[model samples]
Target: MSDRQTSRAGMALALAFFSGMLSSSLPTPLYPVYISLYGFSASQIMAVFGVYAAGVLFALAFTAKVHIRTSLYTRPLYAGLTCVLLSSLLMMFADNFMILILGRFVTGLGSGILMAYINRSLIKLFDTEVSNTAALTASASLILGQAIGPLITGEIVHRGFYALKTPYIILFILVVMSIFGIWRSRLVINRHCTTVTIERKSVGAQSYRGLCFRDVIVCCMAIFLSWAMASTFISQGPTLARSYFNVASVQLVSYSLSAFLLVAGISQIVMRKKHHYSSLKIGVVAQLAAVLLALSSVHTKAPSLLFISVMLEGFAYGAILVGAATIVNMVARQSQQHHLINLLYIVGYVGNWLPFSLSVMMDHFTQETALNAYLILCSILSTCIFLSAYFAVRCQNITGRIRKN
Candidate 1:
């Protein structure tokens, strides 16, 4: 392919990849809408959310190794796209709670598979070694798509809440557009193929036995902590909006989330330029600040203050995530890169699910008090992340994502 042709194809591939990864979070602001329509509880919402994570977990447990080694990205891409299509179909048809979980699970599985494939494939697409570009693109694709998805999805849902069919109709349209991108991308990439092998996949046997399980777990604490804090925002922010502001607007929820997500995405781009950004210090201070800001918002009960605080906290969270992902990529072998990424994603989703569910249990308390409790918990978890990044990451050895392991 000529340079001009390759550039055009690359843009198309990027669109498909971005579309696939993004649809996972398009429903983020719409969950409350779903609850209103289905008359489901928050715990039920957690279960439904958990199904998204679970779908990813199931794919990791079985398909991670198979897909990465095969060098055939299109087959999995098509399968994942099919799964996404099915999810929208199911949501349109679903009446009961079981079907809700089924839709989320399908969406989650597609997201999980697409994420692993796209992140890894980027390295191959440009004939470049694994570096922050792939990761930066990955982070951008996720945060931006998520940021935009809710804003767009919420608008459709806002309209549908009155008429009652717009949310499904919008999602159905998104899924179809996503499929077109995936199909066109497969053709684009194949024509300009620059196939390569991942080095880590060739590691000798019994190596995992030598990796100090205790230390590796310790090393991973930052990743998990980052997720826990991130999840708290996602799972509770809408509910808090309801309590403190009497927010009935789905668009309000969408706009608020879009603000936080915007800050988060912009932070990653900002960190990309800082060659010497401190992972440990940044992660630690940001979380500490987030906790204080959160605690204050509860006492004050000001939505403006709360929005500013969440945006600040979100900026910090975005930095921590990019840093943590960078660390994971740096620490693991090339072959192990996808595995470690899978693990990081798992921890992140676990953080995403558990606290929200726990908050549901705590929903019995007054909303203000419940908000306060989660703020304290999130602060502590964030502190743990800070401490790990501080101790484990340094300029000497961990210059960037490509570690010397």
Candidate 2:
């Protein structure tokens, strides 16, 4: 392929990846709508929300690790299109709660598989100079798709469109367009690259043998904290919005989410172009600010305040993920690429996955009490991550000194 041709195909592949991700979270704002449409209580809605994560987890365990299937990624742009079509059709049957849950699970499955494939594919498409650029694009695509998915759906729903099935109808069209995108672009199916190696090189073989103590406890807490706090709005936002502020429409909540995602997506471009430290420093500051805003919303009970806080948190979350992924991707060896990718996503997804479940568990508590408890737990976790990064930095400094000595 010519240089220009390869670049074009790569970008198209990224676009395809981005669209698939949108389907993963498109149902976010509509959970309340589904609950009302099918007469499900909060617990049932939470259970259904958790089911999407479960589907992804099962795919990660079984499907993602297989070597043979990956050769089909560009072609399975077909599979993604097919799944989106079926998942959308499934939503048409979502007159009941069970169908809503079923459609979401299938939707999650399609997107989850696509996520791993896209990350790996983009990494291969570019050299190191533009590797981070590709990663940023991948990251931005994720932020954009997830951010926009609900907003678009919400707008259609706000306009008196089909209530339960409307988002799916809209999404069906996007997926179809993405299929055409696949056709217009020449996608190379590289047969040589197979599945992620079970054993990573360069990192001590012993290190690979077991999850280190720090990995299990400290790192786990850091992930949980970052994710729960970041995604708190997803599970509770709909109910909370409905109860206190009289925020009835799902589309509006979707917009609230889009606001944050939009900021994150736009900032990524700025980060790519400028490549400055100010953004990194500001991202840390944003995390601190997000915590404060979250606490403030708890006191004011102003839904607007809470929504703003969620957006700020989303921005910080994006920055943190981008920074961390850059560090990991650099530090990990060539053969270890997929493992790093898998582990990072596993942590990131856990943030979304477990937090929703926890919000449900905490629903039995009073709203104020639940918010306080969740905030406190997450705060501790965030502090721990900052400290870990600090020590890791210090450790690197000391190692450098010793080597010089």
Tell me each candidate's TM-score.
0.77, 0.78
Q: Which ten residues in a row have the lowest lDDT in candidate 1?
A: 204-213
Summarize candidate 2's per-residue lDDT along 1-405 as a digit string, tens digits.
467766776777667667777777677667767666667897787777777777666555554466544355565456656666788889767777787788878877766666666666666554352236656867777777776776776666678677567777777887777777666653453433432244334333322232223322333344455566657776567667787557889678866766767766766666554322233434555676777777777778777777777878777766655554444443333444355555666666777764554465566887777777766666666666666655644554565566557
* Runs with alpha carbons beyond 4 Å of true place in candidate 2: 32-37, 68-78, 164-166, 183-224, 238-256, 273-285, 296-308, 331-333, 353-365, 397-405
- For model 1 the local lDDT of residue 401 reads 30
Which ten-residue region of model 2 has the weakest summed lDDT? 206-215
Q: List the residue pairs that clash in candidate 2.
A: 154-251
- Whole-model lDDT per candidate: 0.63, 0.62
Position 111, candidate 2: lDDT = 69
RMSD after Cα superposition, model 1 = 5.7
How many collisions per candidate?
Answer: 2, 1
lDDT of 1 by residue, 1-405 (tens): 466654554555455556665667666666777678779897898688678888887875556567344347667767776787788777667778898889889888877777666655554454433345655666677777666766666667656663234555665676577667656656545544343344324432121222222223443565565566666667666766786667778568757776787888888887765431354347557767867777887787767777777777677767766655554444444345456666666666666654755467465887767767777776676677556555544333343333435
